[model samples]
Target: MRSPFRRPASRSARSTGVVRVDTRTKRLTKRLQPGEIAVIDHTDLDRVAAESLVERRPAAVLNAAPSVSGRYPNLGPGILIEAGIPLIDDLGPDIMRLHDGQRVEIHDGAVSHMGKTQVIAEGTLQSAESVDAAMEEAKAGLAVQLEAFAANTMEYMRGEWDLLLNGVGMPALRTQMSGKHVLVVVRGYSYKEDLKALRPYIREYRPIIIGVDGGADAVLEEGLKLHMVVGDMDSVSDKALTSGAEIIVHGYRDGRAPGLSRVEDLGVEHSVFSATGTSEDIAMLMADEAGAEIIVALGTHATLLEFLDKGRSGMSSTFLTRLKVGGRLIDAKGVSQLYRTRISGWWLVGLALAGLLALATAIMSTPGGQAFLGLSGVLWDDIINFFRALVGLSPQSPTV
Candidate 1:
């Protein structure tokens, strides 16, 4: 007989059991097979992940993990269940060893295994009758934080708007950025350690660079100019505040503004946008309304972690906003069409030869040749690595 020790290439028929999906928001937003249990790991990202999960609206969203075990009022599986999808939270680790399609049974919003490898999850027990109810509670709980965010944001906004409208300072880094393709880069989940690849394009197109809140700080740290900044002002940095970009504050929908006073203290110009959604979103919307032809996205979320970090019903509005601007959205992550020139051993060799020639010429004239070569070599390496990672998604750019 053949050895029985070897395993198959993919999921075997015997282990082909369905995974139980317990969450209501993510996995349940779309159609899910009978056996697949949705895996949930809601980390501190944003709603960008919903872009992917919203497509599958599964039978149930197995909140492999939920915000505060579903105790804290938030929009996670809570919204999923309201959409008629079963939701379960805190399913524990054992649930991970499941296939995409599998059988499961849920009771009291918890897991209950039924058959061979068949698993289930106990969803959130206090099931709200409607999404509105859950959303109301979430909004109520987040009210304090939201107000603080609003106050900071509104103050920043009034200042910037005053500058832009009154032409007080002309947005420190403002240029004729009207016809450029503006890509508002954020330091969201995927953005961490991911933006290294985008520098070349940043140098190439030189679009109107706008960052949301601390995204401006990230840009400033990267040695890039920021034309404008937008957010509730809670997470932005002082460096960004003084970075010479126009700031816009996101205010509360109810007009109970909050973040404005803080902006006033900083003495920055701003405009208030009373809306619901992420600041990255506000940036995109502002760009779109202001007549940006193409809006490329970098460090945007399309995963679970980002949405959870927000812990707000803003995902609902974000969902609709994306649809409204779907055609204009382009992901620039690991993409290279915007860049020119390829880096290879041959190009490096050419650069080396050029450096030698330049050194020879400079040395012939004076003793400063070595110093010039050193400076030029450093600059060339930085430029080359930036484009290389822009094409290959390598971490080599920022290091240089």
Candidate 2:
């Protein structure tokens, strides 16, 4: 009588707490210190949070991940429990409607309908060991998803996403009008940090900024001006919807466009590009084809881990696509290596005061900082001297 995903009205009355899923396990482990929730698209990798139980443990994990492509074991929640972290799966559609610091309750999952709660973590959930890995994963996942997504979700991915590389297997931006550079911004992924790092470069180079749907919203949130947007229109904000950036909806081969309709509903100017690749990738191709000398990536994904999480065929597609635009493809991961935050000189002064207090307190105490007291000091020093004298004299070496 009712759709499964859309919980009926009557059920809401008895709902004790909302049940959510953990999508990005890896990110959850890296980002959540303790007492934080994990929200994301999907999960198939060993999560960092799980391994941290022996070291930097967290309180619980709230997974926003899809269970087995909409079915099956949903290993994410179970794994969290094994790692000493409570996990919940599938909070429901449109869960992002909740703000960053919003308080809410979760019920069900490995944690016996996981108790009520609130999220306390700060920043994107991803914690890649290296930028290079993140990039490979992001690019590969997008590529695979785009190829298959072309045939099935052509209408939605294209129109809303400005993604043209559908079944055709290339970024529409690569084929069409070429006039400006396209800057892509991805949130949650390590890409966001990359984007921030490359801000100076983007500003100096003056490449046209193209936000990937919600990425557009992220840039604007930071007060950065965007020239275009690409991606499925699902996650983008109302402000991005109304922003004056040029909108080109990526569509299916049949010519259906979701983003176009939404824009038309509000009577906004929009175009369509139907093909077979990700909105982010398409943005790069578009900028390159548009006659831009360089296409620098910000907050972009191109890593093995990222691809696996995308839950689609991305590895091959990303490889081929990048080959199509080799030298021009520059991933801006850790571009901010040289930019260090100025340490407050006052911070050191505070530390000096703390040291003084500890020293004074220890002097007046009976134990007198016994933890710092050395044992067998002269014996240890003599042993060290003997070792130093014999250091370079190997048993088989010639007499020196």
Q: Which has the greatest TM-score? A: 2
On residues 1-400, what C-alpha lDDT tens digit does candidate 2 reach at each position?
2112221111111122332233434433334444444444444433222343223444444434433232111123323434444433344445545443444443333222224345322222221122123333344444555455454443434333432243344333422335544455754355545666666666555667778866787788767777777765756766886788777666655666667767777676766766454666566666655666666666555654444444444333444456555667666664455433434458889989999999877765656444334334545666666676698633332222
Q: Which candidate's lDDT is highest?
A: 1
Q: TM-score, each model?
A: 0.45, 0.50
Tens-digit lDDT track for model 1 on 250-292? Answer: 7765674466777889998777776545667667666666667
List residue ranges in candidate 2 displaced over 4 A. 1-85, 89-181, 254-256, 338-400
> Any idea what lDDT model 2 has?
0.50
Candidate 1, 202: how far from true, in Å?
Answer: 0.7
Model 1 spans with C-alpha error above 4 angstroms: 1-177, 303-309, 334-341, 344-400
Question: Considering summed lDDT, which 10 consecutive residues are worst modelled in model 2?
Answer: 5-14
Q: At residue 290, give the lDDT of candidate 1.
A: 66
